[model samples]
Target: MLRLGNPGRRISVGLIGMTFVLSIFAGRLIQLQGLDSKVYTAKAAEQRVRPEKLPARRGAITDADGHELALTLEAREIFIDPSVVSAAKRDQVATALAAELGVQKEPIMAKLAAGGRYQQVAAAVDPTVAQRIMDRDFKGVGSKHRYRRDYPGGDLAGTLLGFVGSDGTGLSGLESTYNKLLAGRDGEQFVETGLEGQRIPMTGGTLKAPVDGGSVRLTVNRDIQWAAQKAIADQVKAVGARTGSAIVMDVQTGHLLAMANAPELDLKNWQKAPPEDWVNRSVTDVFEPGSTNKVITAAAALESGAVRPESVFSVRDNIRCADQVLRDSHPHPMERLTFSGVVATSSNVGTILAAQKVGDEKLYGMLQRFGFGVKPGSGLPGEEAGLLPDWRNWSGSQRCTVAYGQGVSVTALQTASVYQTIANGGTRVTPRIVAGTTNGEGVFTPSAPGARTRVIGERTAKEIAGMLEAAVSTDGTGNLAAIDGYRVAGKTGTAMRYDTRCQGYCGYTSTFVGFAPADKPRLVVLAVVQDPQKGHYGGEIAAPVFKKVMTFALKSKKIPPTGTRPPAVRIRAGE
Candidate 1:
């Protein structure tokens, strides 16, 4: 009954409603196309494009012989977008991936079940394994390019070469010292991608090329280093020593031929090695120089005109300095001995008496000039400056103890440099291990040789060399250090290992330092064995090590023996 009003009125009402609906649709179109177009377009583009990192390849490290110590190889990192994988296919996908990656299924399953958009399944996987997984074309699994460090030499020179971290950063040794030079700048790349995160072929993208790192060339001679390492390691084990170190250097140039340490770390698996095995003990550890330090006192005495090599001394087994008593390594009768004889025999009592004539200032000055109490400037990290109290702080006992290498400490490298100075004719040159660096462009930049400072007169150096020569002859304390067909000159030392807990001596550190072809010294080798249980004397434990290393070094350098006989000198208690 209510529908009877009119068809004309109904048609008018319909037209008005239609007009209002059209207007609303038109207004929304204008707002979307004009007012907010940029915001919507930017969001759409962001979803389509993703930026990825372009990793840079790290540099290589080589020895003087161009043998590879460390380098980087191409590796793959596998990732998964768990959100794209279905629960029904999860177990099958994880099994296949685990088989290809050589990993357990549990870890892969855990990552698949993480319920996240992205997860890393494996890192630093071999390229072949990654390729196998990619060949399968799994629903959510893929791999990206990466770099991993490789040490081909295993544990050889491991401490010196150091290792890299999981993030591809250098962690120690030369790797850490020159990290900036070795780690080049990383670049970037942008790629258009689909909704499922797969790269779209022919989609527009941008890229910035990466710069590869520069290579480092060291002065180490691998052959000589191998020989030295073998010699020291065998000797240390034979003597039942805690640890040992040996250094061979070119006397004239201060280039370290070889710096070998025992208890080395395996560079490939350094993470499993103890922290102590990764230390370069030659530069980091310090101990008293023992009788080997008497050379410094002799140089001081001769330079100060307090005594000559021919000067006579009335010696005794022990001498009193303040309340403390200083004694030689062994007891001897009262006798008259020349200065040269005292040094050849390593007479601690005679050295203290001679040191008294020069006093503390002159002796301390000589020690500083010899590169003790300071880092050798080898550019190695964590180098310690051994303890050398100022002469002004020297107590009566300190002065006498220091005269024969007590109350002071020095590193193995510093101890080697002392003899290198005399062998290089009294000029102390800074030791260098890195020969130079090479850039990506193949341009080499040589490292500057260390500055040489004259520590004593040339004549004084020769006189000391001659006295050292006598010490290695049949008559003296270092006779075991003599090499056939080579006039070797060196000093033997056995110092008490200072224990902080006891605040006194607990063990002995035996050392032998010397050079071969004495008159024209070319190589200076120093061997130090700490806490030897079987034998404690330097002549017994350390001297033979020195001889073995020096012999190999001399032969490796192809230096012909001087073939000259050692000069005649008297080393008896009375001369």
Candidate 2:
């Protein structure tokens, strides 16, 4: 009897088991569709919505003449959806793309075999090359527009213009200083993507357009910059120096015309250049002003009423101060020299004696007034104020050494500003590199001129100008800085290069700072040569560079000659 009922019982048990399995499946379905539906829906939305980055166009950098120094060009990057490419056509596509892009077939094939939603095949492709690839219209392959920085002038103003990084960020120079103005705002777009990451046409969700960057117009003259660069490079090579720099400025407005450096970096491949080559030495490097600083000492003494242009001093080959002895570059007997004559001749002994009359506090104040120990307000990156210790910190010898431009240090730009002040009737003006900035709408806003500070009386500046004119005469050390048909007012500098290894002076740095048409100065130029192997004297190595650069600047600007020759000054003979 029990056997007879067993078949039906077994059937009932089988039905129950089947029902339990189906109930479990139904419960899971409800949990997925209702209980945790928001979580599942979020996952689906995440897969469909794709974010696209829209790059902003970088602004162009132009010289004063509107010549493009740095600009951007449209580029393309090729990508592939490997999963969407057919196995049979994969080899064909890889071979064709490799040939067109000049890339390795093996890598393309490997990417295709690996099978992914997205893979980069080529980057920074020329527009023409991208068009050719689009013509073929290979399945699963497409290109997106991108921006690439181009410097058409090669390295013409590399140090001043700086370079852009791979991510399109400004890395140095004006580019870095004005990065906010140059790197505009980036944009974003949201679109529905297919399974293979392809944006579906007509399915755009949201978009925010990019705002392009503003262009920067510099005060630098391209032609004058080229001339200054060429002259400095040639001089650096001729003198076998480590490096050289030259800067030309408008004496009245302090607008920089040219900031040139030797061994300039190629903007196209600046990554491979040495870090030192990337620096704008005219603003960053500091050295003693040597005789070039004599003008400052003379100005301080004259300003304090401690000395006059006609004041007399007994100058010797060497002079004792505290525990140290200061000597001239050459041997000479003790002689009486006018204060102006001492400055024009760059006599170290006489300058120290004159400085003693002014005292340390007054001298330091005068130096600060001339833009020393402070930034020149050029708005350049890494501009150094140079080192000038306080009067209270100065020892007896230190005071005299600073008077002769030994204990103090200065940048070439700062040195140029000193001469510029004298040329501007003792009024110091800030130096500026950028002339203006242009918005995307093409509206330009000119940069504000620097503030004017009176450093000396008008009469004192004229007297100093006369002395500077004498320095470029037939007898002074800076005679080589003379330019034909143009009255030159400048001073020469020869300072010992400090050696970090020995912690003392080792080599020489030759420098010259001047302005043209001494009567009515227009252009102020400063030239510096470092560690020259051929000649270490400023008159021999640096003055000629200043002359060449200044001559070109004067000519390029069409500055008419003053025609009046500078009056000859006397230096009393030794007994």
The number of clashing residue pairs in each candidate reads 0, 0
- What is the lDDT of every predicted structure here? 0.90, 0.89
Per-residue CA lDDT of model 2 for 178-252, tens digit only, reads 888888988888878887666689986548888899999999999999999999999999989988999999998
Clashing pairs in 1: none
How far does residue 391 in candidate 1 sit from its true spot (Å)? Answer: 1.2
- Residue-level error in angstroms, candidate 2, position 193: 3.2
User: For model 1, what is the alpha-carbon lDDT of residue 282?
Assistant: 91
lDDT of 1 by residue, 421-441 (tens): 999899999999999999977
Q: Which candidate wins on TM-score?
A: 1
Query: What ranges in model 2 sit over 4 Å off?
Result: 1-42, 82-116, 121-123, 573-575
